[model samples]
Target chain A: DVKVTQSSRYLVKRTGEKVFLECVQDMDHENMFWYRQDPGLGLRLIYFSYDVKMKEKGDIPEGYSVSREKKERFSLILESASTNQTSMYLCASSPVAGKRTNEKLFFGSGTQLSVL
Target chain B: DQQVKQNSPSLSVQEGRISILNCDYTNSMFDYFLWYKKYPAEGPTFLISISSIKDKNEDGRFTVFLNKSAKHLSLHIVPSQPGDSAVYFCAAKRADTGTASKLTFGTGTRLQVTL
Candidate 1:
């Protein structure tokens, strides 16, 4: 079985603070993604990394940045946390690139971040 | 614009009854569709999927039906149980030229099954 682990299951941060969410996958997948899920808004992509040091912006990348310094780890950075930034963050990885067609995603248990 | 939409926000059903969750997409270029189930505080898990070439797929008590002309798909769970209560999300992927494998997700529908 594939295992994707997130560092924190729950976090509380103050406004204007910097926050980091870490994720690691044991499956050696090539693609990693960060998404924020909200009620009535669905899961909107924040950022994705296809390879080490390569990143792309997803639909809603504002105020969010990602780092992929190694193949097994991906990190999501909140430049300056705000109350509106509170959300459930999810990390997922897939083995191949043709995810639009031929791959299945393995997801890590989400981190619920609260910004006060 | 929202490419995928789940109009129903919630559904309530009795145990042992059938529960149907619906999803619709406006993008005709999407060739693959997937269903995911999520519990509170947990990430979404892949449940079932179907390609545009086929119209239906079934596994155990769950079934997925697709209608290309209507650009709609639905998930059916028979003999629904209380444990089946959760949020269901539908996603679509268009395998066109440069879109990569990124999936577009829809707003979820919360389902609660009672005794």
Candidate 2:
């Protein structure tokens, strides 16, 4: 069983403040992803990392960035939090790409961030 | 453009009945499909999946049926229980494309089961 742990279950931040959402996976999967969930928008990818220090922008990456300094940890950074940035953030990991055609992602419990 | 779409936003079913959730995709490149169940405040869990090669895949009381020509899929849960009440999301990704193989997910269908 792959266990993906999120550092915070819920967080509240003020506008213009910087925020960090951390995630760590125990299975040592090579791919990590950050997504934001919104009503009518579903899960939109914000950023993803395939290797340490390597990151790629997903569909919606504005005002957000990610850091992957170690193999097991991935962090999502909100440069300047705003009321619109409030969302349920999810972290997911999967085995190395192309390892299997039918591979599925293991997701962390998620972090609900509220920007006031 | 939103490749995957879940037309119905919500569905209600009585216990011991069948709950059907539908999904559709516009991209023909999508070869693999998956269904995930998400409870409130929790991440979605992988329920079941079906490849383009197969039209139907079943696990326990959950079944997924895919129609390639129509580019649509549906998940059917028989004898639905209260525990099955949650948001169901349909996700799909193209075949074995190493790095850029990101999945496109539908908005989701919220299912409520009444006893």
Q: Which candidate comes out best when scored by lDDT?
A: 2
Candidate 2: misplaced stretches above 4 Å?
A100-102
Please tell me how candidate 2 rates in CAPRI terms. medium
lDDT tens per residue, model 2, A1-116: 88999999999999999999999999988889998999998999899888899999988999999999998999999999999999999999988866773258788999999999
lDDT tens readout by residue for model 1, A1-116: 88999999999999999999999999888888898899999999899887889889999999989999999999999999999999999999886654553446778999999999
Q: What does candidate 1's lDDT look like per residue over B7-109, in tens digits?
A: 9999999999999999999999998899999998778899999989999999999999999999999999998999999999999987762423578899999
Please provide TM-scores, in order, for all candidate models, with all chains considered together. Answer: 0.95, 0.96
Q: Candidate 2: lDDT of B111?
A: 100
Clashes of each: 1, 0
Provide the lowest-lDDT 10-residue window in model 2 chain B: B95-104
lDDT of residue B103 for candidate 2: 75
lDDT of each prediction vs. the true structure?
Answer: 0.90, 0.91
Which residue pairs in candidate 1 have backbone atoms (N, alpha carbon, C) closer than 3 angstroms, thus clashing?
A100-B101
Q: Give me the overall lDDT of model 1.
A: 0.90
